[model samples]
Target: MAIIKLSVTERRRLSAFFTCLVLAFAAWIITVLSNPKPYVVKEVLEFRNTPQKRAFRPLQSDTVNVTINGTGWDMLFSKMNSAYKAITIDLHTLESKSYVVLSSQKDQINSKRESDQQIIAFNPDTLYFDFSNRKEKRVPVHLISAVRYQRQFFQSGPVTLNPAYVIINGPASVIDKITSWNTDTLKLDSIDESVVTRINMQPVKEGNLSLYPKNIQASIPVDEFTEKVLEIPVRVLNGRNIGEVKIFPQKVKVTFTTSLSRYAEVDEDFFEATADLDLWKKNGYKTLPVVFSKIPDYCHIIKIEPRNIDFIVKE
Candidate 1:
């Protein structure tokens, strides 16, 4: 390193030069921070005061683009920390089937805004809405969950929903057409056990309809399953029983599959295997298809061996 020395007068001049530069920079920064600027942004509008039985279709946009003016520092701070409320437009006093000008009610809209940012002007400068009464009804909430088992596991019972039904309310014309509401699709790939969770409903934008309960508790019951074979006896009914009739085969081998919980409960008592006498008499066929009646839920019938039995009238 090389050492260099300067006179006291030269050092003072250099220090003063640096001091003036610092002062000038500080003044310029203050001017820029204090100056007010305009920012074009969109503000949300919330509708309120409508009849409980009626729903309005929002024909106009629910947001307005406006020019807001404020100091840069204040604007930046507000942008980071300011929480704005949706501008409310009351439709309680307004009549149905009529157009209400939002520009005329700009003061009412401004009154609802709590932000300190000054809105210079609205971009469209005009707003209107066509309000109408909605139709309402109670409909079933259908839960749709696509689930797959990991292997040898199956749903033991029906998929249950905490809130099975939701109130569907909207325009009368639109509501009349809606019979059922469906929830969001749920998928469980290779599910090995039972699961219970909260799921949200699908938003119905058609006809501006709304569901009272937007979410529900879904439960999918699952259990390990095994194949079960039940040997159900085949009984001849109706015409065959009326006359002296003999069936070539008296018993049938019924094979089925069911969940482990229900494996033992499923026996001959839970189901009925019958050969309808009327069907035999009407068709006059040598063999008739066996009809299994009152099968238990969650029980899957796999194979019915010797599905038909030959019958002959005894002298």
Candidate 2:
């Protein structure tokens, strides 16, 4: 409940004291961080100069704990840099040796990094790999896409990929299970026209597997759609007595939507409607349901008039 106010001179002295204390703290930090120190950071491992005669699969994880000797500034910035995430290891020695000593290649690895930072050591000081029979094969390329079309717009035809197949080289056991290689997802919104672009293929997850031509060209056909109506004759399927089975409405109207470019090319011949007579013989159904046995590609059926037809089976 007591108010004590200091004199202006006393307040100035207090402010100066605090300011000096802050400067001393900053000076200590600068002195300590300026000196070189060893710090540990985990980095991904990538292999280069892979042996051609043999296929390899690492027995351990693809990451290593690397001890880097550098100033505090270098260590701080290296962690923040995305490029520092992975360190490439030379596999040239694998051609003759089964393992690689990380320390022996420290100089080679440090050459690619900043001059201020040096790789001193790494955990799992030695890397071991398992060898397998090398094999090469050609597999089809599968495109992955997520596209949304505008109103009355659709894909008119199948998407075409340049170099429809890619060559893969890897361990025999791994390549045998892979039938196709998939491209990275091609995402688009409100697609109204054909798409022609180059997309990169998905990176091989296994370190040993390799793909030629990391990217490919893709072409997609898109067109506006319009409604078309056709009178399709219904054929009786699985009829024990074909001539004896009589169905009302032999022909039904088929309404469907097709691309504008192919509107005139489509007709009743492109569609096959059928009424199964087995419903009355086996299931004792009163009416037969009209089913479409075939339809043109990319054609979407909207409605079929008289879905179920009245039938009379003569004994």
Candidate 3:
């Protein structure tokens, strides 16, 4: 093997040549990207000025390939970014015709976009729609939620919505299948106090369906809960003809959880416990099981002192 070493001046010249070569390559790239050209990108379709008197369902997909005439930089950026703004299409012409030609509205669509980047054309140049009878109805709004409460804290009452129902207008076939609309999921953790906020409804997936008041006001009542005990007398049931009925335990202690606001108001009157005599006569059971006929709303029962009672009937 032979070792050859170059002079310092020769190495310096080599470095300068390579540096110029790299700079020239970069300059070429910049110039190419700065030049204007036509590029194709996919855009979602947004329909506006919908005919109020008719309902329509698009026969094709809601996406279209749009040819945009702009600089090379614009093309590169549009390809890099996945969230392109949707193209708005006017549907006022639909009142007379069932189809729309995109070329006819090129000027109008271009007006809403950046002046430098113009929409040259779009694939699926023609959009066809299926028409049906329009129907409007009011449907209840259902709340979707996943909440965790702090210890001894919980929802005190039913959640209330400012506008309990929303108006939905769409094709009769689609409207008939929809009974209610749902709000986006309300997620909360370690909640201790009441909540009041505005939440958006789940967006309509079908292009033909429309919802008014896309968002609603939600009021959630929350409170701290405590244990409440009450001694309720057990009443005899289905023992009409079996005149006198004596139970070993006449009353039972009921323990339950109730909100602080309602703790004092809740008492024996709020609950009803009864022992059915039919279990002893027909079922041939020796003891009668105590059952609750009524209980206050939102009150959770913990335990009953005497679940089964020994009763004797004197005929």
Best by lDDT: 3
Each candidate's number of clashing pairs is 5, 0, 0
1-315 in candidate 3: lDDT tens per residue?
A: 998888999999999999999999999999999998899999999998898998999999999999988988999898899996798999999999999999999999999889767999989899999999999999999999999999999898999997999999999999999999999999989999999999999998877789988999999999999999999999988888877889989999999999999888998989999998888888898998889999876688999988988988788
Model 1: residue 296 alpha-carbon error in angstroms:
1.9
The lDDT, on a scale of 0 to 1, for candidate 2 is 0.90
- What are the per-residue Cα lDDT tens digits for candidate 1 across 60-140? 676777776777776677668645545565666445534445566667666655455656677666554445576668888
lDDT of 3: 0.92
Q: Candidate 1 or 3, higher TM-score?
A: 3
Tens digits of per-residue lDDT for model 2, 1-315: 999899999999999999999999999989888889888888899888998888999999999989888888777877787664788888988888888888888888898887776788899899999999999999999999999999999998888999899999999999999999999999989999999999899999988889998999999999999998899999998877455777899999988999999988898889999998777778988888999989877799999998999877676
Ranking by TM-score: 2, 3, 1
Q: Write down the lDDT of every candidate, Cα atoms only.
A: 0.74, 0.90, 0.92
Of the pair 1 and 2, which is ahead by lDDT? 2
TM-score of each: 0.63, 0.91, 0.84
**Which parts of model 2 are misplaced by more than 4 Å?**
1-5, 77-84, 241-243
| Global fold similarity of model 1 (TM-score) | 0.63
How much RMSD separates candidate 3 from the native structure?
3.3
